[model samples]
Target: MSRPNILIYMTDQEQAQVSFPEHPCLMPRTEQFAGEGVRFRNAYTVAAHCCPARASFMTGLYPSRHGVYNNVNTHTAIHRGLNDGVITFSELLSEAGYRMLFSGKWHISNHENPCDRGWEELIVSSPGDRQSGIPPTARWEEAAKVSNDTRGRGQILRPGWGHYLVYDTYPDQGPKGYENDRDYQFVTAAKEVLPDLTESDTPWCLYIGPNGPHDPFNIPERFADMYDPDQIALPPSYHDQMEDKPRIYQRQRSQYWDQLSEAEVRESIAHYWGYCTMMDEMFGEVLDALEASGAAENTLVLRMSDHGDYCGAHGLYCKGVPAFREAYHIPLMARWPKGIVQPGRDSDALISIMDIAPTLLDLADIGPIPEGVAGRSLTPFFNESSPTSWRDTLYTQFNGVELYYTQRMVQTQTHKYIYNGFDFDELYDLVQDPHELTNVSDRPEYQDIKQDLVRRMWRTALAEKDIISNPYATVAMAPWGPGIAFE
Candidate 1:
């Protein structure tokens, strides 16, 4: 029997709050996949931003260890991609005689193309709004201009309050009409190549990356109108009383959320959901192609997102500043019928997206994961019995971007503490304030709890040799409370 093929479907900035058993309106194919597999309830991204999070997925190391601190494409200060010295899971898979195919957004490395990273057939999308010197709406127009298969009538650029620009396609033809969209193009490319993959003798790994539901809050008309904007409910933390929180919390709210009226916020969220539905349709197309090509039976399929969007949570729009569950927690699900005997169960495992690499290698039986890799193999969790040594806490770090901020978060099942190296820190009693509206870090009553978390964070950083140790170690390592200074 041949080795199991690996199929990874990744989305940019998709939050766990939307997929299956959460927001059930969209992503039917995704929901079906989850029904037949294992879903990780508490999977998180190492960093809240894009580039670093994607880098972490590629290499099993944190941002500081990987040496790509900020977003490479957007940040001028960071020119480095995944360090040449680090060995990626893909490199290991390639060496094991697996054929690799990559299509869609390749943001992991700036200088080296995906071809250099073990992919045999690479179809890279046009650079996004930030990279291209054009109106963000031009992305849609560029897609239409280049593809005869696209049914998008035209691109719509609607300017809102604070000069907020929305990019969407005027697709009168419904979901199938978005064939010209970037994600559709990417999935179509994958579908076209599936036949050859099934016929080939060697096992294959196909990585599908789509940039959607991330921003611009624009999608084809069919999807945008799928849910009534006025009927959409507000986020639980919509009215975040910013009292006692870090100064950046209020600043972020004022900068990003203060400009929108209630109606605009609703519409923006509605479009975001629509974009997710569009992505769902595209995902279905790829899944259909896989089944049609007879490769679905032997394929180990995984779907996950790099970080998440705020989606009006805490009165915020995009990711940045004061990391929280809305931005850091992501959705991770995997389905491999042959390897996983028991499916359709939710595992509340404290796992990081960085663990994906080693997990895939384990499934492929590729063994002896390279040295210096900081992630753990998730193969055991796929079994019926939970590992007694499973981790209880997860650590996430962010080193500033867009707004220039630094934050370290240590989270457990009940409580969470964030150490913002810039202005102030935040602590949340998840049981009391699940939405994380109130910051109890500076509160007198929670001082001891805060100190204990800080000590745990310091010890974890020391044991793990986290990169933030260089500057903040001396201060964080000192006698707990007095050293860090709560109030």
Candidate 2:
């Protein structure tokens, strides 16, 4: 019941379905530890993009509250930082006398690094990399040159724009070790820090973030070869064609992804799954380090991802304008050997990634996170008590990935509705068409359903004080306006 050491491992662009007990993605470490902790089957990110979702995780507030809805990287950003007066949970931990150590990606805000938020930065993909002072990795020179057959399977050549490659092998890698990879470097740093943590008197918190299995699923040949593309099958939704969905969804497909032949699509999935396997291996190494540190029995180990990847679902690669569940559903797992009553359990209770901040504070017996925060502590789910007051609806507040489009979503167990201010709206019967192959927003029978969802959307949007919750005559779009919430 005392303060426990916190060890967090957050991956990038990984979907929640992959961590299901029945999922096909091969993750040996996850499988081994499957019953050692709790697996949240309904976990989700508030936004699909990294910065907004990560900010939600760090602050327990949605993108609108945190004021970051797009990528916060230096080169290609519009709104490049979090809103003023934002307080990350790390700052609270630091005030409570915990040593916060971090390595790998921290895209929450480009204005300042994790150190500015209370963490001691460490490793190659250091949190400091988010700041403009750090040099970016050189890719322009390599992308401009005319390519031959030397291009890897993942490479998508662009004459002017930088070449897009999500999967590739390293020159230093054969089949055994991956010394040159960024993920390995980050994990190694976390591993090195674990030993020193055991000697310290302070209850510490260490965060390891790896930008992998994300895009350009770069890995060794050994990992990619693990899944034969021939045996892989396309997603059930791959043939949807998006004829019933929004036009922007169709445009995204036709412009970029639809070019891939069925063979290529299958190959892309194989590479993504293989990259997942590589991530699992890297995760195991950190767990091994924790075991060696002699704090394995008391440390609170967490495995989560910033958001989900399309990964060939609906003929898309990465997360973007789409409102598909493949892009929003995220993986979250937790293990606390000395604290949790039962190590092995899966909870179907609805939960958000933002809930992480307050959950940690609750577990540590620290003061609750700032009032008015969107996320409530998930302590009941962790304890397997399933609080009766838990929320049923999970909402998404998205602006855009890089482009600007105002969007909001509200989803229940059986139905989902997306309010897009840019174009049209969307509604889906999750029970009837689980793959989201059909859009029911335009159907006469579903009009009532749409209205019901719209009312809920407005209610939550108003409560959250979302930026898009405007009453302007032109932008106050949606078949049922904000006034419907009162009706």
Candidate 3:
């Protein structure tokens, strides 16, 4: 084992497409970063939301196993924290004599910060806002106070009240405010600590999480100018009405995003692309710092996101209740000069954020992770020699975001099946409908495919001890039973 120094730079709500060499979101530096390593073209999040996916990266366990089915923040949350004694990879690495430094957003829990998991926390975002992100009940008077023109340009109204500012510039910060942006601060923290870690003899781990390319896409005027709305084309699937899918999906679209005009959607996408480029530029700084310290050869740098955002695909802005591919698929790239075999290569192997913990342990020769962990080591793919026996089917669990919906997704190379506990199921043949324009769940011809996918779903749920299989009569609403795990 090379025992490389680990550096992780994570961005929030980044789309998987951004990692592609031909993506419209022009990120030369990020592209350079990807070229220096292996890009897992098929990387995905265990869950779509922030906390649950981040938790999976930390523990290498599914949300059901970690007891964080949804956001663990101060927003309409069912759980405010993780289950007791959840072992994070950082804890193991710290014990293995690694200096753990964390900067930027730590959305895993309100009850505890990264410090609790053996990290030396620094310059983090929303560290201890013990309140839920969404309140259980809204103030009627405040809702009534919203401006009469709720769905006007730039601002959009919710299903009824509450105006949401979609995209705009920082009013008070002017054009240069981006210089002091929180993302800049996160990078600054990383730069400040890199020197000390480089000089130290002990191996170290540094995590930089920048909050960007998330909701609203509010960015600096300079960055926004990089993209033109007129030139930006909405995703081909953006016109999907979602009529063939569940009513909840339609309701989510019609209620929130429908208010935005097509032009506005294009503008939002432009802003999102600009945001990605901004983060990419900041990331280049960290890369520069690493090279300056002369530890680039032995450092394992992981550039990825907690999850992805739908930057106007299916008329959705942020990731949530919708069981769409845009929400689950995330950009994942890894670079370790001494450890990685094929530099600047891409692997289509199905990878999960949860795979990070186990892969790091494996490369460090830290040996077996705790029992019941779900992720497999990505060392084979890193070596450019993926074993023939690798998994062909990938599964994702999404209990909810801020809003609750029991959605389980099982995707194979050719098809995708989504079991929406709240509504009817959805199935899409990726070969025919890569954009997911149609739902063939009810087609008789697709019944065989649906059945096979459902059986696979139960296989993962049963293996992970996922409690969603409660078949106590009234709640056992899945089209297939847990018995399918055996059948």
Candidate 2: Cα lDDT at 95: 90
| Per-residue C-alpha lDDT of model 1 across residues 423-448, encoded as one tens digit per residue | 55789999999999999877999988
Residue 389 deviation, candidate 1, in Å?
Answer: 2.2
- Candidate of highest TM-score: 3
**Span of 10 residues, lowest total lDDT, candidate 3:** 469-478
- Cα RMSDs of all predictions? 13.9, 12.9, 12.6
Question: Compared with the true structure, what per-residue lDDT tens digits does model 2 show for residues 306-368?
Answer: 888887787777885677999899888888888777778888888899899998888777775
Worst 10 residues of 1 by lDDT: 153-162
What does candidate 1 score in Cα RMSD to the true structure? 13.9
Q: At residue 332, what lDDT does model 3 achieve?
A: 89
Evaluated against the true structure, the overall lDDT of model 2 is 0.77
lDDT of each: 0.72, 0.77, 0.79
> Candidate 1: which pairs clash?
none
lDDT of 3 by residue, 65-180 (tens): 88777766533457777788678999899988889999988888887888988899887786755444442123322443555453566666532134566787664254444677
In angstroms, how far off is 418's CA in candidate 1?
Answer: 27
What local lDDT does model 1 show for residue 112?
65
